[model samples]
Each structure stands twice: as C-alpha cells, then as structure tokens.
Target: MTEDRPSTVGVLLAGGLARRMGGGDKPMKTIGGRTILERVIAQLAPQCDGLILNANGDPARFAVFGLPVVADTVEGFAGPLAGVLTALDWAAEHRPDVEWVLSAATDCPFLPRDLVERLQRARIAEDAQLAVAASGDQTHPVIGLWNVALRSDLRHALVIEDMRKIDRWTARYKLAKVTWPDKPIDPFFNANTVEDVAKAEQLAALDGA
Candidate 1:
C-alpha cells in the first residue's frame, strides 16, 4: 500500500451467474496455464492491503485461494452492484480501518498493476467519492474503487430501491474516471466466452503473464 493513499481491501467480484459461458464460474477457466482468478489475484494482491472474494454458492470451491468468500447480502443475484455492496459490508465488519474497497471482476486476467494506485490518486485529485477505469471510450463500472463509508446507502439502494445497474448508483455521487490505453492489449480486457478465452491465451503471451 502506498503511504499517501487510504487503506484499501480488494474485492474480487465473482458472484455473477456466468450464463453466457455455459453457466459456471468464469474465473476458474484457465488461460496461460493459470486460472483467470489466479491471474487477477497476482495483479491485485500487491496493490491492496488485504483481499476478499464476493461469490455466491458454496464458498469451499474457492478455498484453495484462501480468501474469505462472502455471499451477496442481497438475496438474489443482484449483479455486480451486489458484489460491491458485499465488499463494503464485509470491509466495514472485518476491516474497519479500511476506507476503500477496490472491486474488480475475477474474469479480467490482465488488470493493470497500477489499478488501485491510479484510482486512489484520481479520486483524491478530483475530490470524488468513487473512481472507475476506462479504456477505448468504454467505462468498466465493475472495476473501480468504492468508499466504504457508503455501505449503508449501497445497502438501501440494493435492498429497497432494487437498483441493479452500477452506473445508476454511481451517478448519485461525484465519480472520478481514469483512462488507460488500449493499444497492444487493453489492460482491462476480459474473457467472457470460449472465443474470448482463445484470444486471451494469445494476449496473455503479450502481457507476459
């Protein structure tokens, strides 16, 4: 962790029902001889003070990773926003000292190493309550830094408002957007399907993973 940045806990969002990839844990798929989850962990572990996983169903499946797996506090699969809320609630309960929760999708194998640092810097510079990453004119709402202070509001949005869209909730506050280059290989590139996995295999070599 950087000395100037607030303490952060990384939350790997794996609670989605991967219906597109034949319905299973997408992060468990292997690429470059390693699971996508493994690659995501390698990229984020050094950038966070601690890490937890937001996943539904049996937590024992991810026991090998040795992370505290938290199910969505919201009953049904409420999308990535639910995962974000889970992280916020978990951080508040287990790591009160942590002020931020960095959430990233587990299927994104090549997340930039500077992810947390850059998001923190941008949020502070803009005096924003949240920060998100962008590449090639596209914003990845799921990959961002969340304020742990907003846990209560997020829970209300999830449980009462029935809010499912991440962007809609983020729009309620000041948000910092950080952009990354897409050339060579987009650092935020994700494998969402079998075809994408094949492409990721090739991109992994370029990423030197």
Candidate 2:
C-alpha cells in the first residue's frame, strides 16, 4: 500500500438476498470457472490494505476464502447501506489504522484494478466527504469509498432514520463521482442473475481472466 494514501480495508458486500438470482449466495456462483467472489477478491485484494467479507447467516460457507466474515450490525436484512456501515464499523474496530473502507458488491467480477487509487485520488482532489464509482451515466453507490469515521452517522441513518437508500444517505455528503469508460466492458459489471453470469463468462475472456 502507498504510504501517503489513507489505509483502506476492502469490504465485499455479500449480504444481498439475491431474489432475482433464485435466492442464494450469488457470489458463490461460478463465472469463467471461478466463483464470482473469487474474481472480486482477486481484483480488489491488491488495492487495499486488508479485506473482509460482509455476509450474513452461517459464516462457515465462506471459510474456504479465509476472509473475516462480518454480519450487518443492523437486523432485518438492511440494504447496501447497512453493508457499508458494517464495513466502516469493522475497519474502525478491527483495523484501527485503516481510515477508509472500500465497499464493493461481491457479485461484481470485473471491478477496476485501479479502483482504490482512483477513488482516493478523486476524493482528495474534490475534497469530498465520500467517493463513488460511475459508468455510462450511472453511479454505483454500492461500489465506493467510505470514511471509517462515518460509521456512527451511518448507523444512525440506518437504525433511527430508517434510511435504506444508499444514494439518499450519500447525498448528505459532498460526494466525488468518478466515471470510468464502459467500452470493452464496464469495469463494474455485476452478475445479478443466471443470464448475467453467462454474460460474465464471455466478458471474463475479454477481461483476460
């Protein structure tokens, strides 16, 4: 990790219900002969100081990856914001040296290799409170950089304010939006269904996976 940039812990958000993918761990599904979670890890591991998985239910299912699995602090299957909060809290407690948490959905197999570097750079350049990734005119709130210091504020938003929308919460802060080219393939393409997984298989070849 670069000494100048704030230390960041990568958080793979696997807490989704995956209803569209037939109600199972979508990240565990295979793409290009490897699990999507595996692909996500391969892409993100090198960019962050450390990595952890935000997953609910029995943690044993993810033991093979050897990542520390943390369940959302809030109950009732809160949305992606909860996963973000979990990561921020985890980094604050488990990795005190880490000032930031980079959150990404586990289903995204083609996450950008320069994700951490770019997001950090953008946040610093804009002097923003948060930084998020965008592609082809769409912003991906779930895939972004978060400050560990915002854990309490996020928890209050989730528990007290009942804020489930990520965009709504992020709107409160000065957010740096960094857009990436969609040509060749969108770096943030995620597998949300069986068909998407098939598409990812083809895209994986293009990604040189």
Candidate 3:
C-alpha cells in the first residue's frame, strides 16, 4: 500500500458460531502458543491505519485484546455481510478519512503481510468498488476490501432484503479478485476445527522460521 491513497482501516470478523469447533471463540484457540486473534492482529495491524474486531454476544470476552469490539448492526446474526456493514458504518462514522475497510476472518493465522497493499492495488487498478482475496482457486469472500461509499446499500441489503451471502451482494458491483500463492502455507487458512488448529501449530513452526 502506498501512503498516497491507502487510507484503510481493518475489521476482524470474529462473529462465527464455530459449531464445527465445539461452539466457542475459535480465534481464542492457541497456535504456536499465541491466540489466533493475536496472530491475526500482528499480521493486520501494521498494514492498517486502525483496526477493530467484529464479534457478537459478550464483547467482554474480547476486551483483553484492546481493540474495539463491534457487533452486527443488523439483527438475527446476518452473517459476514452484517459484519462488513458494521465495519463500513463504523468507519464512515468514526474514520471519515478512511475510504476502505479491510475485512479478514479472526481465525486465520497465516494472513499475508501484503494483503492490504495487493488488495488496494488490484481495486485501484481495476477501478473496482470491491476487492476480495483469493488463494490459488479458492476465493475468501469474507476477507475483502469494502468501500465505505456502499455502506448504505449494504445496510439495505442486510436489513431490508435480508441478504447474507457476500458474493451475492458483491456480484452487484465491480469486483476485483486478488490472488495470492498458496505455497508453504495458505495465508487465508483458518482454524475451524481442532484438527485445523493442530495443523496451524505445525505451520506456525514453518512461519516462525
């Protein structure tokens, strides 16, 4: 990201039910002796001007992390789109100078360092309203760059139309898909199960080296 027009804030989408992981904050699980949320923050904090965490129910559980915990503005847990809308509304109201909000899952420990830079480059180059990250052939819809200008439409989709799927909403606009190599580790690999957490621990060793 360039300093010129790269004014972006970050929103960690932590509001997952985690039924596959036994129903708890999967991000709180440890990998390489650090919480996945910690690892996510470390990777994203430097790349963003500011950061916030999006989680539903008991914001107190995330207080120790020291980032503002935002909940879905729309009712009935409207999925990642609600989280993205929350981020956009927050950024629009609080960070007026920030034009873009980068949304990444909290459970992903190996997020790329160049995520923001590359996403910004792709969106700007393509003159796109949104940009999403992809690893090889897998696209991470929850992890993307959202323009603050679309917050109104997003809120409408979530609250009025009850839209939940991210791709469905993104399909309505110009979207840029930015791809990253899935080499030693996939940057968007998330810990959704106990087995995945174990795998992340092994990958953490590779990452530390």
RMSD of each: 1.0, 1.1, 1.3
TM-score of 2: 0.97
RMSD (CA, Å), candidate 2 to true, equals 1.1
Tens digits of per-residue lDDT, candidate 1, 1-209, equal: 56557789999999988887988999999999999999999999999999999999999999999999999988888899999998998988999989999999998988998999999999999999999999989999999999999999999998999999999999999999999999889989888888888999999887688
Candidate 2 lDDT by residue in tens digits, 41-91? 999999988899999999999999999999998999998898899888888
lDDT on C-alpha atoms for all candidate structures? 0.93, 0.91, 0.91
Pick out the ten consecutive residues of candidate 3 with the lowest summed lDDT: 1-10
lDDT of each residue in 102-128, candidate 3, tens digit only: 999998999999899999988989989
Q: What is the lDDT of residue 181 in candidate 3?
A: 92
Candidate 2's C-alpha lDDT?
0.91
Residue pairs with clashing backbones, model 1: none
lDDT (Cα) of model 1: 0.93
Residue 170, model 3: Cα distance from true site in angstroms: 0.5
The C-alpha TM-scores of every prediction are 0.97, 0.97, 0.96
